[model samples]
Target: MLSLFSLAHAMEMAAASSIRTSPRASFLTSSTLKCGPNFISKTSIPANLMEKGHKRASLFSIRSQQSEPKDGSVILPPTSDSEANAVTIKDWEIGRMQDEIVSSQGIRIRRRPPTGPPLHYVGPFEFRLQNEGNTPRNILEEIVWHKHTEVSKLKERRPLIALKRALENAPPVRDFIGALKASHLRTGVPALIAEVKKASPSRGVLREDFDPVQIAQAYEKGGAACLSVLTDEKYFQGSFENLEAIRNAGVKCPLLCKEFIIEAWQIYYARAKGADAILLIAAILPDLDIKYMSKICKMLGLTTLVEVHNEEEMDRVLGIDGIQLIGINNRDLESFKVDISNTKKLLDSEHRQAIHDRDIIVVGESGLFTPDDISYVQEAGVKAVLVGESIVKQSDPTKGIAGLFGKDISV
Candidate 1:
């Protein structure tokens, strides 16, 4: 058996070799590191493993000769020099990759850096400098950053395995797309996906007496083909509990889990909690993630409402296969600006022909209040509409739906 010192030396040389051969980018200097007995010191990480398209950089496995623990639970390896170098490099690569990706697609919103911000030292003090890499540029970016941390902890508590088992007792998946089509045909206008939202970052607390199940039942009674329940607890003041509660209350409207989905694990979690559909924003997720997540939704018998804010995002989602439902969110999530004309702009663009060809159902979302606003988007080619504040704030949410459409659409 090799001594600890010799083993560390060998590993350091191997790591250095890997870094030198990498082609994407290298941000580490060749230097040996020493650590305590419980720790492993590494010099560098492989470059090829840190490619632009590779998302597994932050999830690399650590190989150590430490003895196994008495408990069967997985052991978390102690932090090492190589891990620190890898994390810093991962942050840098993610930022660079996002720049390239966004340039091609014009996505201004940046993903939260894979690793947290780097630390700067000033003599005896340490400071974390704020930049695009560490700081969130917009509300949407900030929410995503918090979500990355939130989902990590949620996964630890109720892993994918547990979520799968829960699905055995989950409510049957409802036909979200079919409901929209049926409602549109029945109502002679865009079908409503009434939102069960209590609050939003842009507009605080829409309803003080918020009862998710109550709101859901009212919306269904008012002829909403589907319902969108915000599951983001931080920014939206919504939760999975609300979703489960509404579904268990026997509301027939297909429940859409309105969440900033960053991981595939969230898709399963939503299904297990009684969601018939889930929202996937094109601004935050790459094309690969969208495709993968959409497939998972299909397998779980869940519908995906892929949301886009601009022509670039609309174009990106159009290229992907198996996309049946697309949402044109009039509100620019980055700027928190609402423009009802965004829907018309995208539909009138070159994408309209392609969207028609694919038989894609486009849903106009946000900034829609009056019947004229509803008419504008319907003429712009949306088969559905997702409205929240205009309807949810009324003394009777059922009556609010009539005011929005200028007539009662209930059955």
Candidate 2:
């Protein structure tokens, strides 16, 4: 029988050949790795076949082995927690393929890199320089990455258990979905979800004299069905404290915690902070995450507004179950370009049919300014509209709502 070294060398040769045939964006270097006994699959080559006096063949990674897959993906026997955290030889090579798949679908947001443990050898640690793919191409991606890092730090300060206990004493959630429907019935037009905006990355300092509580009260008086409170402090110049303040001020309108929710922890946190509902951007989350997080929100008695900017994102949200509110964003998160037509484009006959058949509520968001703008989006197929800039910029946001609808529906 050929020796293990010869067998391994032959495998590496074959793997390298396969990798070369693919596109260059894969960024895979040639693998001519030397032999370790475990490099070969235990099933493919009998364990007894390994000659004596070699490192007992454990997959050190298919770094340079004939035993690995032709594509150079290292498939080790399910490792312990420690090994799981350790960065193996071909970790990045294999992961590069996964990154390519996520990026191929026009999703420029990269997954956080490997977290190899600081004290390796027994625990799982992801190998991240902490900024692997963090250099975002656009404003949306930058905000998402920043939020991911921000949430990770926040979790340490207030773990989920602590947040859960906070929820115990927290006020009960209002009927956020019900409020929107009630307003629509009261008024012949779409329900208004007025935003409490202080600032945005795209539009800096919406109101220099910003009072979250005051703004919330104004929206309520102006006939807002619900209020969207920007809780992201850094980018949006908002805070969870603002949400808590609005709730404490006895503003009767149901509150939507508008933040970049990257983790499930934030949902519990928002609920604890008196959020009646939460916003889930489909662009920032995968299908599975949206599904899982929506379930968590349901458990917490918090409604979710699943936001989508394009047809692809809308399709992914549609594929999910238990999504009650779908917000079609006129502003493309990736490009930061606002087009009210985006609402019409995404809600084609097929999408509208599915939404109607399911009795789902479609919310038109962003770039809505005039009566014509409101009517245009309403005609496109939305039961609700989330207005921020046009209304928030007004001297009296109460009048802003009246101007938005062209009449005082509050009475």
Candidate 3:
């Protein structure tokens, strides 16, 4: 009796051979065998698989007879019908073997890395660095020394520590959805969640004003549902001081601290700076991470706007329980490309139905401007839209809001 492993190995080899002769033949044969942990009988396999199996067997037999036996073994003549069958099998096997070789070679080529620059070396007494003015260390040491310098400067600033302390004693803000619901109930449309971003690595300094409190006030007066303040000082040219200022300014709109959010410490710090919500980008975090962080957000009374980019991201986000709001980001993080159509693609009717069934609020984020742009996203089935450029650049940012909605939303 063949062990399961041996049977599997034989099947793999047979499949490989079939592939080398012809892809279609190999596909047909492989489809016939059910290989899952709970293996059903061949007859019970899917209809498509059965069709492929029949096609493979016919092809395999034809190919087998074409090649003469290498050891001068007597080639038994087959009847007319059997001759046809043998020829079919022979053809398929040859095609299958060819395919297997090509595929294996392709994989090997892909795995090999390109040859590049050669390594540099010096004699025992011949130090390259020693020849220069600063000659005490090697390349690796230089990198470490620079890193140490940076760390020393960072310690001197103590920004994160100050942020932690500020958050620890900070009072909690109002709920993000509650604020949105209130705005929407008062008016017919969902209110804006305007972001105050200075510079993005992708699209540099967006707002010259760069005042968090002023931006927060403008957004609130313009009938924004909430304020999303970017706090990444390095890439976004944002500061925690901006969040702190907006919180202390007594702006009516609930605040969302927009950060990269790789660590839990940031969440606690955001809460300390009077943030009502946090943006969690799904591209960087796994489902488990999102679930864990979301629970932490809830414990701190902070709403999480789980951001996804595509169908796979949406599916991953949906699998995790307790997600109330989903934000479809128009900008691709890896490529840094912005296409407002991304929101449309992700918010299909079927996806909308799934979200509706769970009572999830879908927020369209990035690359939005004008009443038409706002309407486009709203019609696509988002509960709200996040805008930055068109509104922030206006002479009267408050009027920019009315311009976007085509009506006074504050009323």
Poorly placed runs, candidate 2 (over 4 Å): 1-101, 104-106, 113-134
The digit string of per-residue lDDT tens for model 2 on 1-411 reads 332223334555555454445333122122222232122122222122222212232223322232435545444443222222122323333334435645655556754443211111112211111222324678877787678679989999999899998998999889989998989989989999999999998889999888888888989999999999999988899999999999999999999999988778899999999999999987777665677788888888889999999999888888887789999999978778899999999999999999998889999999999999999999999999999999888999999999998999794
Task: List the candidate numbers ranked by lDDT, top first.
Answer: 1, 2, 3
Over 4 Å off, model 1: 1-99, 114-133
- Residue 292 deviation, candidate 3, in Å? 1.0
Ranking by TM-score: 1, 2, 3
lDDT of 2: 0.74
Q: Cα deviation of 305 in candidate 2 (Å)?
A: 0.6
Candidate 1's TM-score: 0.78
1 versus 2: better lDDT goes to: 1
Backbone clashes in each candidate structure, one number apiece? 0, 19, 35
lDDT of 3: 0.63
Maximum-lDDT candidate: 1
lDDT of 2 at 105: 54
